[model samples]
Target: MDDKKIEKRIMVPDNLDVQIDDKRITIKGPRGQISKDFSDPRFSKRISIGRSGNEISIVADSNEKKIRSLCGTIAAHARNMIGGATSGYKYKMKVFYTHFPITISVKDKEVQIRNFVGEKGARTARIIGNAEVNVGKDELEIVGVSIEDVGQTAANIEQACKITKRDRRVFQDGVYLTGKYLETGERIKG
Candidate 1:
């Protein structure tokens, strides 16, 4: 069997402070602060943020070659966290009504989906964690620090309108993802 290896890298934002405590990390910026405790033991990540200089470094020590890439992956995730925390992330979706116009609202932190597919009533989208969903002027915006959160929120909203046992070729009427973003509010140029 071949032994795994551990690779390391460092990432820093153009403007932000990154701090690390044990396995936990905290990223601070003008927008807000993002912190969490991660215990995976697969890699070691540390953050240092101050006037002197802000930096996040990752290094992995293992006996297997794969461990190197695994560490790099973990570090990449950490880098993504830094980027997400500093600038934040958002996902945009648009409601498409081919058959019947659907009305969706975000209230009580839960999304109230109504009048989908000309059904009798509507459906509901379950809000997960701190993910924020806002529906304004035909635009659905999903915002959060964690990419996973924003992505999952979009998923929840999309899944809530999913139609099972229906011919997708014929019944193509529902809310669809019209846009996405990387925390800059600028639409994802696709």
Candidate 2:
């Protein structure tokens, strides 16, 4: 029974405020705040998370591979939270249609796609968390402080326009993600 400890540390940016309570971590910045619970009954007894100075540390008591990986995973998640809090995330989507013109609109935390593939009824995608959707002439933009919410919202819009019954390559009328960007207008590789 080797019980060597494994630990990972994530540096917190000066612009962000991090708070650790129990197994939950909350990060606040100029854009918004996000809180995530890292508690898992399976690993609760083996792993511990805490913040010291300006760094977050994830410590694991067991030398098992799974526990070590969990420590790294928590560190990655914390880094993402810090980045999202400081810079935020944006996803750009473009509308494509052969004949029927597609119209997108945001109404009360829901994105409505009208006349997609000449469909009579409008298709709706739910907005997650505090993400904001802006519909233009032929494009849509989704922005949020949390990467998970922004990315998921973009995926929902893309999935809603999936063509199932149509031909393999003919009916290619749908919404697609074009680019991803940070709040500072820096492009992010998709």
Candidate 3:
């Protein structure tokens, strides 16, 4: 039987500090600190993560596609953590409505959507992690040290006002993502 294992390695930058404990990883940098728990049981036993002399490594028991994919995912997550800790992430959203004006507000770690498509009550979306949500008259901004948390919070806000049981052709009232800004000064518009 030929036994071969797949391994992925990440070089820790000089400005970033990493800590790994069991299934959790924490990264600290100039921007802030981001900690995540990779406790999923699917690959916990088959995969291992460790660090040595400014380098982090992920090793899988086998070279199977699934194992390889998981290793890649974990590596990507680590990269994101490092990037977020260094530069941070920003997501911009715009409120659009044809009939009734929409209002957005953030309070108590929750985003509240009022008068969405003329709804009687308000719809709320929970803010994940330590993401900072800024609600403006027509613009919404989410900023966080973790890309996943900021992006997920933006998605949750965008999905909160999903139009349903209405004519899709006529009623186009909803929140939409307008742009994304990364630490590298790259801008993405949609």
TM-score of each: 0.80, 0.95, 0.90
Q: What is the per-residue lDDT of model 2 for residues 72-184, given as tens digits with 9 covering 90 to 100?
A: 88888888788889998989999999999998888998999999888899999999999999888998989998888999999999998988977948988999999999988
Query: How far off is residue 143 in model 3, in Å?
Result: 0.7
Arrange candidates, best lDDT first: 2, 3, 1
- Cα displacement (Å) at residue 134, model 2: 1.1
Candidate 2 CA-lDDT value? 0.90
TM-score order of candidates, top first: 2, 3, 1
User: Candidate 2 — which residues are off by over 4 angstroms?
Assistant: none
Per-residue error (Å), model 3, residue 134: 0.9
| Candidate 3 C-alpha lDDT tens digits along 42-119 | 889988999989988998888888888988998989988987888888888889898789888888999999998888
Give the winner by TM-score: 1 or 3.
Answer: 3
TM-score, prediction 2:
0.95
Judging by lDDT, tell me the better candidate of 1 and 3: 3
